[model samples]
Target: MQLRFTTDNADAAVLDVEVKELVIAGWVGRDRAAVLHHIRELEALGVPAPGAVPLFYRVATNQLSQQIRLEVVGEETSGEAEPFVFFHRGEYWVSLISDHTDRHLETFSVALSKQACIKPVAGHAWRLSEVKAHWDRLELRAWIKTNGDWITYQQGALSALLTPMDLLNRYFTDRQVEEGFAMSCGTLSAIGGIRPSSEFGMALHDPLLNRTLEHTYITGSLPVIA
Candidate 1:
């Protein structure tokens, strides 16, 4: 799929990028206790525990979108705010993306559930090299609309999860991420527990640079027939 991105440089040129591989990295919390807590949280909803930590799930590249609206099969779905990394022109660029998923399908297969919904990504990105020194200081926040009001959904620092390089190294041992490959790093725990929402908003903030990458999307549920 071809994606348009704006770099953080002074010129801020909009470049067209072609991506072929898409991956979703899960169970990537830096704290073992927190990771287990998340596992239990999902288990309570009938989702099975992952077989391993930082499991990588390959998804279809066509599921990626930059649209502000998404339509899914049912209401049992939610979004996760995460930092997305992609290799382009010999460099890795960082952006914000939501791992929107179907909760109902997740109970049976997490991978399939992820494939059930479209992934929303921001149009702007920052070169990893520009923020590598202060990567841990980056903050991720998400909000969900409930009862006509937007409320905090998730929020945390990048420090809470493994670094991008660490994730790439674990998934692709002995070599760097291949060109045109993109992955969404793990996410933080939901502020008020995971739940479905019609409107979702997410942002990645760089305190040092005083800049943020954000995207919001509205979801419409398609009727389910027996």
Candidate 2:
């Protein structure tokens, strides 16, 4: 994927990132109570509970995209705003992304549901070191369009989710995160409830730096012929 990198002191530079590995880190809430709450919430929607907390699901690298529009098989998909970390040229960068999933398929297999939609990533990113000092304060938020209006979908501080280092350590116990690797951290619960929408917006805000990375996309549902 091609992304633009910008730092506080440097100009933006566009680089091609060869992401050889892609992993979706799910059920990564730092608070066990909150994690259980999310599980129950999914259960209410017919989605089964995860076999383990902080489960790692490997996805195809080709599923990553930087597009403003997406097309899914049906209207049963929704987006989750997440903070993603990627390694390129020996440096790790943080950015915002939406882990859009097919809700219908989620009930049968969470992993397959995730692979059912394109993962939309922000076109720009910040060096992880730039936000590491105040990582907990960084905020993740998302919005969905419903009934002809955009409404708050999900909102919370990054503190609610496990830190990137913690996730990397758990996934790569004996090795460092290889170059050309990317992972989308877990997301916050929806403001009202999880539901499908035609449009979604996501953002990662650095309060200390007074800057934000954002992306919005429209989902076009194709007919699910029986």
The TM-score obtained by model 1 is 0.96
| Candidate 2 wrongly placed segments (more than 4 Å) | 1-12
- Write one digit per residue (lDDT tens) for candidate 1, span 1-226: 8889887687557767798999999999999898988799889889999999989999999999999988998889999999999998888999999999999999999989989899999999999888889999999999999999999999889999999989988999866567899999999989868899999999999999999999999999999999
lDDT of 1: 0.92
Clashing pairs in 1: none
Best by TM-score: 1
Residue-level lDDT tens digits of model 2 in 148-219: 898999998999889998898899987877889999998998888789999999889989989999999998
Query: Whole-model Cα lDDT per candidate?
Result: 0.92, 0.88
lDDT of 2: 0.88
